[model samples]
Target: MGDLLGVAVLGAGHMGADHIRRLGHVVSGARVAAVADPDVERAKEAVAGLSGVSVHTDPSAALDAPGVAAVLVASPGPAHEEALLACFARGLPVLCEKPMVPDSAGALRVVEAEARLGRRLAQIGFMRRYDAGYRRLKALLDGGSLGRPLILHCTHRNVSSPGHFTSAMLINSSVSHEIDAARWLLGQELTAVRVLRPRSSSGAPEGLVDPQFVLFETERGALVDVEVFVNCGFGYQVRCEAVGEAGSARIGDEHTMVVTTGGRAAQEVAQDYLVRFADAYDREVQAWVDATRRGRVTGPGVWDGYAASVVAEAGVRSLETGHRVAVDLAPRPDAG
Candidate 1:
C-alpha cells in the first residue's frame, strides 16, 4: 500500500464509480484512498469492498484525506472548475474528465489558473487519444506517408439520452469528443462550426433534438464532419475516418462477434460507452497514474479543454441559429 499511488476520486456516479473499480482492480500501482459524491451512499457504495478508504460528501474533505496524493475528477461538468482549481492550489496532480468546464469562460479560467502556477498539474480526460485504433491512426497521420489530411468523417451515437438532457447538450456534450479529437488528429485548432438538425427522432424525448450533423473547420484547411445521434436506439458507436491526399484509414468499428453460419453476416454493437471504450479508459488512467507517481503530468492539458469548450460553444450557437459559427479562442497560455 505504501508503494502505490493514493488517488482521491471525486464524484461517485456512473463514471466515478467505474473509475474507482478501475483504480482498485484494473489499473496497477494505484489505490483509492478517498471517494466523494454529493450522495454519500453512492460514494460509500462505490468503495464498499475497498479497505483503508474514506468516503466523504464533500470533495475537499476527500482531497484532504490521509494518503491522498492525487485526484481523479469524474464529477459533473459544472463542478469541474472548482475541483480542478482545488487540485492546482493543493499542488496535486489530477486527471479531470471532460468538458473540463461546461462553459468557455470557466474553461479558460481553469487554463489561466494553471498557467499562473508555472506548471501543469491537471490532465484533461480526452481518452480517445489513448484508444489503440485512434493511436494507430494518429501515428499514420503523423508519419506523413498519406500526405496532408484533407477531411475527417466521424460518427458518434448512443442508445438514448438521460431525462435531464437538453437540445444544447446535443452539441456541447455529445459532439465535444469530436471537437477535441479533430483538433488533436489534425494538429490544429478548430476554426469554425456548423450544425444541422434533420427533424427530431420520434425515439427522442419531447422537444429534445436527437440527431445532429456538425461540421468543423480546422485551422490547417482540413474539414471534420460528425453525425451525432444520442437516441439512436440501436447501439453506442464512435467511428472516425481520416482522408489524406494519398490514402485513408478508419477505426472504431469494434465488432464483438460475427455470426456467418446463417448465410448472412452480423456483428454485435455496444449499447453503452462504458463497454465500448473500457480499454481506452483503462489505458488513460494507467498512464496518468504512472506519470503522476513520477512527478509529472501528461496527456491533454487545460488549453485543449478550453479549446473544446470554445468550439462546443460555437457549435451550440450554430445549432440554435442554423448558421455557421466561427470559433473565437483566447490567447493560449504557456502549457508548461
Candidate 2:
C-alpha cells in the first residue's frame, strides 16, 4: 500500500457514481484508482474530473489496474457474489454494498469464502450502523437505560418506486434495511416473518403492491413491525421506536428548519436516501478505508449480510403465500 489507498470501484451506476465522487473528493486517505462498468462511457464520466484514474468495461481489468490496493463492489446484487469471491481470491480487502447477494444461498457462499481465507476481507455495506441517530440509540440500548426491549415499530416510506420495482422487492430490497436494522438493534436473530397486504395505493404502478406490512418475531420473543410504503408520493422517511420495559425511545423524526406563515408550519423532508443518509455513508467509507489501511476488516461482515438475506428470503415467502414463514439460517463459520 502506498501513502494513499487506491480503490477500484465496480459499476458506475447511481450508488457507484456517488461512491466514486466520495472517494475522489469527500473521503480522505483514498483515491479512485480505477472504475469499471459495462458502459465504458459511464465509467469514464464518473471519474472525469479525477486524475490518474483508469476506466474499464471489465471489473477484473479494473481490479488489475495499476495502483489498485482495494476493491469496492457497487455492482448489482446478482453480481456481488462473483465480485466478492474474486476479491477473496486476490486477497484484496473489499467493501460491498448491501443485499450482499440478494439470496441466502449465495450470501452463505460469500461467508464461506471469507472463512476459508481464515481472515476477514469483505465488509458488507449496511451504512445505517454508522448513522448518528442509530449509534446514539444503540448506545442507549446497550447501556440498559431503556430496560429490556419489548417491541420495535418501524416505518420506511419512499416518494416513489423505480420502474423495476416488484412486489417481492418490497420485502427483499426495500425492507431488507429494516431487517438488518432490527437485528442489529435487538441483538437477536429473527425467527419468523409474516406479511400482510392491504389495498394497493392509487399512486402505485399497475399490478404492484405499493404498501405492505411486515412482522418479524425474534428469537428472544420480541416483535418488530415495519410499514413499507414505496409509492407514498411524498418524501423519504425512516423511523423507529423501541418499546422497553421501563420506557421507550424513538428516532428519525424530521428535524429540519420549520417555517411559520399564515399560522401554518412546514419542515423540509429528504426526498432520497442519498440525501438522508449522506453522513452515514461518508463515515462508513472512511472507516472502511482506515481499517483496510491497517490490514483489518470492520463494520458489518458477510455473516450479517447472510443473516439479512435468510430473513429476507423468509419475508418474501411470507409475502407470496400470505402465511407466516420461519427463518432457517445456515451454521455460522467460526472465522467470520
Candidate 3:
C-alpha cells in the first residue's frame, strides 16, 4: 500500500458524509485524516465510527491541519466557490463536485485563478470519467473499434432531488454529466446547444420541468442528444450509446449484475446518485490523493470543467430563448 495521504472532506451532509463513510472502511492509498462541517455535532457524527479522524466545526480549520494535503468539497452547490478558494489559498489540491460553480462567471474565475497559480490545483468531480463501463466504452471508441462516432444517445434520470431543485437546475444538476461525457466520447467540444421543453410532468413540483430534450453539436461533426428526466419515478440512471460508422458501443445497465429466483428475476438499480457512482467516486478520490502526493493536479482539468460549464450555461440559455445557442470554447493553454 502507498503511504496514506491525509485528506479532509468539507461538509458533512449527504455527499460529504458519504465520502467519510466510504473512506472509513477501505481506502488504501489515502485515508480520512480530518473532517469539517458547519455543525459540530453533524461533523462529529460524520466521522463517528472512523478511527482517529479529527472533526472540526469549521472546515477551514483543516487548511492548516498536519499532513492534510488534499480536500474534497462536497458542500452544497452554493458554497463551492468559498470552499474552493479556501483550498486554493492553502495550495491544497481539491476535488470539487460539479457545476464547477453556480454559473459561468464563477467557473471563469476559477479558471483564471488556477492559471494564475501556474498549475492546475483543482479537479472538478465528474465521476463518469472514472466509471468502469464508461471508461471501457471510451477505450473502445478511441481505439477506432467503433470508427468515427456519428451520434451519441444519452439519458439522465434522477429518482428525485431536493425540493429546491428547479427546471433549469435539471440541466446544471443532471444534464451536465451529458455535457462532459459527450465531449469525451467524441473527443470534441460542443459547438452549439439547444434545449427543447416538452410537456412538463406533474410528477415533479408544479414549476419543475421534469423532462426536457437537449441537443448539442460537437466540433467534430457529431451530434449529441440527451433526454433529461429528473422525476423519472425510477432509480438514478446515467446511460450513453455512441453510434459510429463501423458499429455502436453502448453502456449496459448497471442493474444487470444479478440473478435472482425468489419469485422473479431482478437486478436492482441504485436508488441514490452516490450509490450509483460509488466506485467512480473512490477512484476519483484516490487520483486526487495520488496527485497531491506528487504536488500536482491530476484528473479532470480546468479546461474540462470550464467547457462543461459553458455548455451547461448555453443549455440554460437555449431553454430560456427557444433558440440554438452557440458555444464559445476557451482556447486551451499549451502544455509545456
lDDT-better candidate, 2 vs 3: 2
Off by over 4 Å in 2: 261-263
lDDT of 1 by residue, 215-294 (tens): 98888899999999999999999999999999999998757988887688889899998899899999999999999999
- My TM-score estimates for the predictions, one after another, are 0.98, 0.98, 0.93
Error of 2 at 145 (Å): 0.9
Q: Candidate 1 deviates by what RMSD?
A: 1.1
| Better by TM-score, candidate 3 or 1 | 1
Each prediction's whole-model lDDT (CA): 0.93, 0.94, 0.82
Model 2: per-residue Cα lDDT over 76-155, one tens digit each? 99999999998899999999999899989999999998999999999989999999999888888888989999999999
Residue 77 Cα positional deviation in candidate 3, in Å, after optimal superposition: 2.1
Worst window of 10 by summed lDDT in candidate 3: 327-336
Pairs in clash, predicted candidate 3? none
Q: Candidate 3: misplaced stretches above 4 Å? A: 1-3, 256-263, 333-336
